[model samples]
Structures are given as C-alpha cells and as structure tokens.
Target: MTTEMGNPRSRDIVLIILSNSIQRLTFLPVYHHATVVVMCCLWLQTKQSLFPIALVTNASVHVIMYGYYLLCVMGLLPKWKRLVTDCQIVQFVISFVVSVLMLYYNFTGFGCSGILGRCFNAVFNASLLTLFVNFHSEDYAKKKQG
Candidate 1:
C-alpha cells in the first residue's frame, strides 16, 4: 500500500489535508470536528512524540475507509464494508493502548509531552469506539435477522 511519494512528511501532509477535507465535505458529527481540533493541537506541540502514532494509524484507516467509499461510488459495492468498521475499532483500541503507555511513561520516566491532549484523545476515542461498535451491531444485526 505504499505510494510513490518518497517523503514521509509529504505523505502525512496529503493525508491530513484529504482527511480534513473529506470530514468537512461530509459534514461529519460534532465529535469528529473535536477530534480534528485536538489532533491539530497535539501536532502543533513540538514535544508530543506519540502524536505520530495516532496520525499514522488514523490516516491508514482513513485510506481504507475512503477507498471503500470510492468503490461504492463506482457501483462496485464491496461485501467487506464491515472490515472498515473493524479497522476503525482496532485503531481506537491501539490508541487506548498507546495512550496508557504514554501515561505510564510520563509518570515513571522523564515524562512524556501532551499529557493533557492524551486525556482528551482518550475520551474522544472512547466515544468514537462506542459509536462504531453500536453502528456495527445495529447494521449487521439487522442484516443477519432480515
């Protein structure tokens, strides 16, 4: 899934732009805007080393999710829509693990940066995870029953 973009920074920038643009165009929920703002704040802080993990994971998920949308747009609806939701859930779980590790390191070690941002991120991630899980259950449960 690698692109010809030789520079990682360029790829990150493009992904961020595309993600934000898509979010705006789709008029995503308020929580999505909050997540974007929190991420921007985390990125602006120079000391937040863990921000890249969140960025890369989220960007990767967006790539997959949007790719699915593209397929659907071309009248090629894939049967693996559930996989996108699964990937999103996995992304949040990974974020939770990374956030916990960040907290542990902040307390036990020299201290990590963006501790406050991490707290906000944890709350947002939890809420998003709950929403995604509910969507998965309701969507697929009805599919199964009907």
Candidate 2:
C-alpha cells in the first residue's frame, strides 16, 4: 500500500528497516562467519596454516560490510545514506565475487562439509545482494524519477 504522497507507508518503512537489520546481524553474517570458521577448521585438519590467514582476511571483509550496513540502518550518519545507497551496487558486486571465489575454492580443494559451508555463504550473499539491489531501486531510483 502506498502513502498519500505515493511513498511507502510507515509500517513498510519500519518493516524494511527491521528486515535489513535482521539480515545484516543474523542471516548474512552467520553464514559468512560460519564459513570462515569451518574453513579454518578444514585448514587445520589439513595442516594448511596459510588458509586460515586468508579465511580471517575474508572475515574482515564481511566485518566492514556488515558494520557499514548497520551504520546505515541506525542512521548514525544520515548524510551518508545516499552514498551508502549508491555504494550498495559496488558492495553487492564485491560480496558476490567473494562468495563465488570462496565457493569455487572450497569445491575444488575440500570435501562435502567444506563445500556445504561455502554454499551457505554463497546463498547468503545472493540473498543479501538481491535485497540491497531491490531496496536501492525501489527507494533511490524512484526518487530520481520524481
């Protein structure tokens, strides 16, 4: 349902905000972080110390990503909202590429369990990126038109 101004309703806005926050704090991070830990475990089991270092670095990327997403949701820097919205495209690209790469590595180098973790990461990233793109287009794209 549309507001009188043809914008979304307050309820919709609140729901969107809550949904975004929930995805950031829970769904996205859980899979990404879990994959990192699982990969670290796999690396340890295989006596591959260098792999865990890469896994930690990969985790740091998600840290920056979710941290910024939370900042946007919190409106801690309202001035940056437009910037964040625009940057969402770039963020999605980065996340998608990373997930795909990790998935490829896990599939090639490890067994069933490692591949499963990477698959979770891939699915999470896909969902998160889809949300970002749809939100950006619905929110910002229409603003530009009118």
Candidate 3:
C-alpha cells in the first residue's frame, strides 16, 4: 500500500502513525497527569527526607523529557519523530543510571518499600528503553539499509 504522500504504507508506517496518533490524543495527557503525581510525591518525599537527593534531581530530567514529548505530540518540531527517537536514547541512558544509583543507595538493607520503588524504577525505564530502541531501529536502520 502507498499513501497519497507517496510514502509506502507498510505495517511499520501504519503502526508508527497509530502510535503517534494515540500519543497525541491520549498518551501525552495521561503522561502529564502522571507527572503531577510524581511532582506531588517528590514534594512529599522532600519534606520527609526519606529518599536520597538523586530522586529530586531525576525529576528535572523527567520534566525535560515531558516537554520534548509535548513538542513532538504537538507536531511543532520538524522531523519530530527522529528528534524524539534521539532524545529517547539519551533519556534511557540517564534514567538507567539514575535508577541504578537509587538502587545502590538503598542496597544496605532498605525496607520493602525502598526495594519495590527501585524495582519499579528499573522495570519502567527498561521497558521504555526497549520500546524506543525497537522503534529507532525499525524506523531508521532499515531506511538506511534499504
């Protein structure tokens, strides 16, 4: 199949369009709501001083990525998909590092909550990183080769 724009309407292209459309219509809004929860939880943690300072620092990275996500969803950035794929690679690296540091800090016999928090952190970051890696390879690597 081929689109009117002369682009091949392959399965990958269809999936990409569907994913972006879903992100624009729903995912981004839900993500913003989740950010509110994160911010509130961070603020509460700040008051308690339970978590290490890295948690606070990591929030800034999330905010930066959220802004980039918003821009991509809004179609304000040209070549936005490529730009976002590149940014996701950076985000994944930073997230993985932060998550590991968080786990390290609490390795000395932390409570169940502490352990679970790090577990969730690792899983979430890893999952997103995998998705982005697959997307990047499918979208760009094949294009370059073919």
Candidate models: Cα lDDT each: 0.71, 0.53, 0.54
Task: Give the Cα error of residue 45 in candidate 2, in Å.
Answer: 14
Error of 3 at 134 (Å): 0.7
User: Per-residue lDDT for 83-120 in model 2, tens only?
Assistant: 65455456556656865776666668843334544454
Each model's TM-score? Answer: 0.74, 0.43, 0.47
* Candidate with best lDDT: 1
| Per-prediction backbone clash count | 0, 0, 0
Local accuracy of candidate 1 as per-residue lDDT tens digits, 1-146: 13325434344445657767644432234446545665556555645668777778978987897889789879998998999889989998888887777778888986777787876677777777787788789879999999
Candidate 1, residue 4: how far the Cα is off, in Å: 27
- Sorted by TM-score (best first), the order is 1, 3, 2
Screening candidate 2 with a backbone cut-off below 3 angstroms (N, C-alpha, C), the clashing residue pairs are: none
User: What are the candidates' C-alpha RMSDs?
Assistant: 6.7, 11.7, 11.6
Regions of candidate 1 where Cα sits further than 4 Å from its true position: 1-28
